[model samples]
Target: MKCNKFLKGISLSVVWITLSICSVSANENAAEVWRFGLEEIEGSVQDIYAQAFKRKIEDKSQGEIVVEIYSYGMLGESEDLTNLTANGTLQLTHASVGILGAQIPEAQVFTIPYLFSNNDDHNQAVLANNPAIYEILGNALIDQDLRLMTLYLEGDMVWSTNKLIRKPSDFAQFKMRVMNSSLVIKTFELLGATAIPMPYSQVYGSLQAHIVNGQTNPIFSIEEMKFYEVTEYLIWAGQQKFTTSVLANQAWYLALPAPHKLILNETIEELTPYIFEQQIALNNTQLAAIKKSKPSMALIRLTKKEQALFKTISTPIRQQFIQNSGQPGQRLLEALDKALATEK
Candidate 1:
């Protein structure tokens, strides 16, 4: 009887151990299948970033974490993705600063027209020795249950129009499609154009129908969306240097193991320069392609004086934004200004 009792106890112990092991395996498996989504896949940016992110996650997790990417609005629109991420329904998203700014008004500072004159100027302002600006922006996002993982790429924005935008006066009677941002709407209005806020997906159609005469976008988008086919002129306003952020749901990110998180952060840092290089190359190539394919399309270069005139007209809009965003926006603008000055 003593022997039988001892044997029963040992069997029970073995069963408990098996169950615990299975439970752990299940939990780890659950964490491994990560879902990453992007709004569009029109360029190699999305592809390269996704690949790099997945590789890092997998490597860091020792093959325990696998990331699946959905692109081209496969999951939903940018706003929908933002909401889902905030609620922890989605794992990750890559969105332009415009969409991010709409959600977190402080991000709008990046969208301020002519915020950075050129890529080097913008990189110097945001990239090197700039902890405060990124911290403020990332913290603001974290407050809303999101993590700003990385600033993925910078693309130069220019105005595409059917008419020549030779000077600020040329914009007097123009109507352009602007994103749903008060700053953007006001900027165009201040620049002497009628600003029509619309979804990006609709901009192409609007331009096709002649409902709006012009819009601004990066060269990659102009080539990918075939915007050059509809617009006869491309004015190099460089009005906004576009950037995107890789965001993760806070809950999901927090659930990750310490090693996994470290891996992701490190990977993002390593991949930043490569992504930036590709973006610059693609933008240049697309511009050349547009010029070659559409020989009639004119690329307008604005003089320094003209750019200054445009900025002067748009100053009031910036003031209003500062007033509306209150201290946070004001602080962000101040930080950006300081960074820009330090760069020079």
Candidate 2:
């Protein structure tokens, strides 16, 4: 009987060992999941892009890749998301140059007011994927342990203010909410407003509570955040374009299997034009919604002369950016200029 019991135990041990081996093999071949984060909520350009990317990646990989999305504040603020991505805690994130500026100082060049022309072709055709520009920005990002997947625009930034602000002088009495970036603060300060550096998440409350009289963002942001309800003016001065960089954890990206890497590159290229069109549609629809909801709110588009006045003061900030970012920042600016000039 004792011999029979020992034999039964050995049989059970073999069964357990076989199960363990199979489990390990299944896990090895299981689908890989990627986390994609957005700095804006649903319906924003970032959200649209991420959704398209998620679909394409999953489809192309035939279930080998899966994407889980986190949109605005789900994983914390913009800077936090970038940190998570850089450290490999988050696989990917969408962030503005200002958010990236904290870690990648050279990225501050994009925060320079009027840096790109107020033309779609200039922004989309040239600046979006400019080899000269990304080559410099890419090196800067790699040092920060981030990879630039793509650069995209939400829309032209407009001021949601309590009053009309057509010229720099008109900003005399304004308290403008700017991102927590020195360049952005300096840009608004140069424009004659008392720039208050704050997190993007806090801007709505600040505006509603009168902590700040105004903030600058794309038309979709004003509508999405319902800023138009509190602010009395929508001033389109074209101070800057809201360019967001899609980033990946550099080390993780480098380690991706060759096919996975190919899938990502192909996916981004496929969605580029669609993403641009969606931004335009969102801005147009949202702007109309804001005006229809608040007929009393003024929609102020600055005349060329009025915009030029603000642009002139903005020039000094470019020199300031070069000083802050040093040689690399200077290169990025030069690259951007070369691309824009080439396009022109």
Candidate 3:
């Protein structure tokens, strides 16, 4: 009886040790989740691209890495998410170049008017395939504790107003909502408008309340935000072209294993073309749909000469951006121009 009791105790001890070992191994093999944040609504281009990224990462990583997305300001607004990404609290985020400029001013290079004639031109000039321009912009935020993963041209920006704005003087005395960007603000002011900087989330209510008479954004944004509801005119002024970037927390990205980093970079390169195509398609479709659905709303397109006049008016603003952007900003602008020239 004594021998049997002693053996039973030993067996129980062995079982406990085995269970502990298994627990440790299981913890070691568990996947690491990379969280992504998007300020846009679900089914929006931002959300769609994010979901695709999450899927690609998971499938390519074979369950070793998991990508979790928080869309529609789930994690936070652009500013909050930018802080989270910089401080390494969040793994990744997507934001407009203008929004990212608040964190890394060098990103404003893309806001230069006529940087590309259209989305296709912008894609060909500054996408993952073109390392010359891509690397400069991508690495611009490394010092800010964030790293740019990729860039997509959102679309051409247009002015939507309650009053028709056919010329630069037409913008005078009118309140125009703009992103919290000095370059954008300066652009509106140069065109003779009162530039009111506001967060995108507040734009609709502000329009309703007449806090601002008008705002500028891509066709997709104008439609998505339903600006036509409160406004009477959509002006295709093509004042500024908008581009957005995917950014990763520098610390988190640097800490990734070599294989993991390879997987991420490859996945981004593979998926960039699709995202760009989708953006172009959505912009075209929404532009047409908005015009159709809001037939009562005026859809105004400036003649080439008229657009040239606006560009001439904006030259000073461009200079202001270059001067304010500092030496690196100058270099980036030059590099971008060089790339564009080469493409031409």
- The count of residue-pair clashes in candidate 3 stands at 0
Q: Give RMSD to native, each candidate.
A: 11.8, 11.5, 12.5
Tens digits of per-residue lDDT for model 3, 1-344: 11121122223443454355346545654788787878687767888798899999999899999786877645545666666566554688887888767656677777777666444654544555556455666666776777878887667787889999989899878999988887877777888999999878899999999999999888888888898788999888766677777889888898999999999999888777787788789888988888788889898999988988888988876577678778777877777776666543
- What would the per-residue lDDT of candidate 2 be over residues 141-185, giving only the tens digit for each residue? 777788888888789989999887877888897899988889999
Worst lDDT 10-window in candidate 1:
1-10
Give lDDT per model, in order.
0.73, 0.82, 0.76
Ordered by TM-score, highest first, the candidates read 2, 3, 1
Off by over 4 Å in 2: 1-29, 342-344
* Number of the top lDDT candidate: 2
Those runs of model 3 whose alpha carbons end farther than 4 Å from true positions after fitting are 1-29, 129-136, 342-344
| Descending-lDDT candidate ranking | 2, 3, 1
In each prediction, how many residue pairs overlap at the backbone (N, C-alpha, C within less than 3 A)? 0, 0, 0
- lDDT by residue (250-270, candidate 1, tens digit) is 777888888777877787787
Where in model 1 is the C-alpha error above 4 Å?
Answer: 1-31, 117-129
Clashing pairs in 3: none
